[model samples]
Target: MRVVLDAMGGDNAPQVPVRGAVQAAKELGVEVILTGKRELIEDELSKYSYSGNLIKVVDAPESISMDEQPSKALKKKNSSVHVGMSLIKNKEADAFVSAGNTGAVMAISVFSLGRLKGVERPAISTVLPNLKGHTFLLDVGANVDCKPHHLLQFAVMGEAYAKYVLGDENPRIGLLNIGEEETKGNELTKEAYKLLKKASEKGLNFVGNAEGRDIYSGDFDVIVCDGFVGNVALKLSESLAKILAKILKEEIENHFISRLGAITLKPAIKSFKKRIDYAEWGGAPLLGVKAPVIISHGSSNAKAIKNAIKVACQFAESNLNSYIEKNIEKYG
Candidate 1:
């Protein structure tokens, strides 16, 4: 299958994207189309040893920066983000991956490709490595304000994603709230609780509300929240993971005995780091879209980009959109 990447959208730009695209083409056996300035992409690409024929470049002279407003950037027809979306819209590519501006990607995607047939609004489903295995959360920074119906749709989409992409048989769905009780949250969560319970009676394996502490507790397979709360949770987790890792490193260096202990625990520490690394998942899948599009981290490295391609390929192979539409209709 063919996958298109926004080569000039990330922090490292053409280099990381080019290297990742080549690695993906070689390792994943998928054709990659890099969209950006032809010369810059070629220059970076020439630095690597790859199957030249498997990787192609489509010239997109302009690029949308991370700081640019999503609404304003959408008007740039020649931007890499725009061009990449067009390729997907035209069916020239199976999926598109980018580590560029998140807002721009989401905005352009909805305007260019439209949402799935019964989807109220598309949500970003981000998978985090939990103690048991993993937990999928949405709408992470997509829709700031949402209705009760929107949260239900997020639950439905999250469960479908857990089954298809993450390979969970019966993923438990939970609403992120102040407390686990039905009477717990603001008006939004309280109303959504009843709807989710009703949905559970239908087909969903809806578990009750999930507190913030329960996020990494691994009790819930999929957690649903409005974009505001979800984004805060996501940011806090990412920051805490990095800070804790740094603190451990410093503490190990401060004491000789601690250093010796660290050496003994080196294997476990390495394994723990691998589990929480965002690079491993590559990117978050923009669930509820018409096709697959992975939104990678802005600071993504070559490894992250390659893994993002793997995710895009997996998404393309799954009947995700159709499954979501069918499930939404059941609830409708």
Candidate 2:
């Protein structure tokens, strides 16, 4: 399978992405097409030794910056984001992975690949490590403002992903709300609750509402919310994980006894760190698009980019969009 990497999109552009692409081609055994200035990409690629045919380069003179407006960025047809997306639109590549501007990637994807037949809006689905393995959350930052039907669509898309990709059977779906009661949230979620409950009859396992504390409890397999709330939750959780790790390290160093204990528990600590590392999952898939588009963090490293490529490959191989389309027909 072929995967396109936006080599110039991330914070450590060209270098990190190029290294990651090479690693993916070597380790994952997939052809990688790096999109960026040909000279820059080739320069970084020369640092690594690999099979000539496994990695290719496409020149995209322009690049969309993280701070650029999505609408304005799209006007640059030669931008890396646009070119990479176009490759997928033309079927030259199976999937596109970018660690660039999230808004630009999403906008370019919708513009180039279009949306699924019945999809009103595309949602970003992220898998977070939870007590029971993991939890799938949707609308992590795609649509800040959504109507009741949009949340229903998010639930349907989230459910399809959890069941097919994550291997969850009858995935428990929940609406992110303040309280567990049916009428707990604002009009959007309250109205969305009724729609989700009704959808439960059509095959969705809508399990009432999910409070903030239940997110990592793993009680629910999938949680749907507006982008505003979901994004805040995602960022806050990430920060908390980092701060907790730092605090633990500081405490361990503060006392000689604690430092000695840390050495004995090093393996466990390492395992815990791995569980919360964002690089493990690499990227989040933008559902509802015609083709598989994986969006990585803007600050992604080589490992993250490589894993993102793996996710794209898996997403494409699963024929996930077809399953989502079928479910949308059933639940919409």
Q: Count the backbone clashes (under 3 Å) in each candidate.
A: 0, 0
Q: For candidate 1, write residues 1-332 as lDDT tens digits.
A: 89999999789998899989989988888899999999999999888877458899999998788989998999999999889889998889999999999999998988898999899899987989988889999999999999998999999999988999889999999999998789999999999999999988898899999999988999999999999999999999999988988997898899999888887897997888798888998899998889898999999999999999998998899998899999999875
lDDT on C-alpha atoms for all candidate structures: 0.91, 0.91
C-alpha displacement of 196 in model 2, angstroms? 0.6
Alpha-carbon lDDT of model 1:
0.91
Tens digit of per-residue lDDT, candidate 2, span 76-148: 9999888888888888999999999999899999999999989999999899989878899999999999999
Off by over 4 Å in 2: none
Q: Give candidate 2's error at residue 150 in angstroms.
A: 0.5
Give the TM-score comparing model 1 with the true structure, all chains together.
Answer: 0.97
- Please report the candidate that would top TM-score against the real structure: 1
